[model samples]
Target: MLFYLTTLNLARFLKEDPPFIGEDEIDVQTQQAIDAWKHAEFLCRNYLLNGLSDTLYGVYSVKKTAKELWNSLDHKYKAEDAGAKKFLVGQFLNFKMVDSKNVISQVQELQLIIHGIHAEGMVLSESFQVGAIIEKLPPAWKDFKNYLKHKRKEMSVEDLILRLRVEEDNQGNEKRTLNPNAAKANLMEHDRGSKGKNPKHKQGPKLGPKGGIAKKPKFQGKCFNCGKMGHKSSE
Candidate 1:
């Protein structure tokens, strides 16, 4: 605004208030100046309103001047002093990686906290952030934590997180691949168990009536004509 007003020779209107005796009664000079100021104020209002969310623009839009609107917005978002720094640090300390999402997502959330602290002018070294994240990894990632610690190359936070995301993707693909095979093996075993040995090939008592016949009576044969146990001769 200052730049625009100074370069365009409208600075005086911003510096000194325009005569407000009455819009219709204003002289040509006063009218031109007021018109210029109103135009500039309109542009400024548009700028602020454009940046604000639909819900908040109405609150700051009521300000009478460009400077007041800008200052109000600045104060609303960027709190001055070291107090915000302490708050950001507290957030960083309280952040913990949970197993709710992939390791990459958890790490990204922690990175966001580190970035929030940085945005407050509290600089944290890359290595420090990496170590903090490693320490916060969920219990399931113990082996991965050790693997990262043993790496000879110190990786950037972005690079490490990328690797984590890739590892998670690979793990997911492998699980999908193995699950079908495991299910198939289990199904085959169940089918084999459900089917008994073939009846024709099986070794067991032969099929019979509900109860076997009684033992045959002892055999006795005689010839009636000869009355001989061994033979019968015809007379």
Candidate 2:
């Protein structure tokens, strides 16, 4: 809006009031200057009014001069913008990352909150923003967050985001690699448990030629020295 007003050289009209000269004392030169100023003021006022939304236009259109309209708008929006800045600050401070959501997506949300702060004319340094993001990482990322905090080199927001993406991808790959091994272990444990609980799956002795269970043979030779029958000498 300031640039638009500056382009037309009518920005001064917002700060300066229209020239006042007595009708009885006005000369041709003074009259001409007054008319020119009036025209410029009119253009300035119209520009300001046209820039407003329908709601504000109705409320401020009755302002007679550019200075009046500009002052009124400044008074109204200044407080509103201050309140908006406070709300954005609160959001930034309260934001937290959770394990269930994507880390980069949550970082983007934090970036947007920072953007809103900038739009409100508040400046947040890039290093500060990077630190804030690290501080807000999920509990699952505590080790990585500590590593980031301990780095001696300064990091820009872009660099921080890149590092975060790499870390997130690595973590995801590690989980993918471990999942199959974990499943295999669980399956092995379940098989062992089932075998222990049910004894019907155990194998019995082999069958003989006639399909009867095999048995040990009894001794039939007599012991010569002892003159005993149905018993072996070695027994």
lDDT of 1: 0.72
Clashing pairs in model 1? none
lDDT on C-alpha atoms for all candidate structures: 0.72, 0.91
TM per prediction = 0.45, 0.69
The sequence of per-residue lDDT tens digits that candidate 2 reaches over residues 89-208 is 899889999999999999999999999999888999988998999999999999999999999999999999999999999998999887868878899889989887555577878999
Whole-structure CA lDDT of model 2: 0.91
* Candidate 1: regions farther than 4 A off: 1-35, 46-58, 79-92, 98-105, 112-123, 140-153, 158-185, 189-235
Q: Once model 1 is optimally superposed onto the true structure by TM-score, how far is the C-alpha of residue 32 displaced, in angstroms?
A: 5.1
Tens-digit lDDT track for model 1 on 1-235? Answer: 5475467554443334424667577888887877877887666556656767888987877877666666776676666546778777888888777766677767777777788888877898988987898888888778888999998898888788877888788878888887878888898778777885543575655544656654535425576775657554343
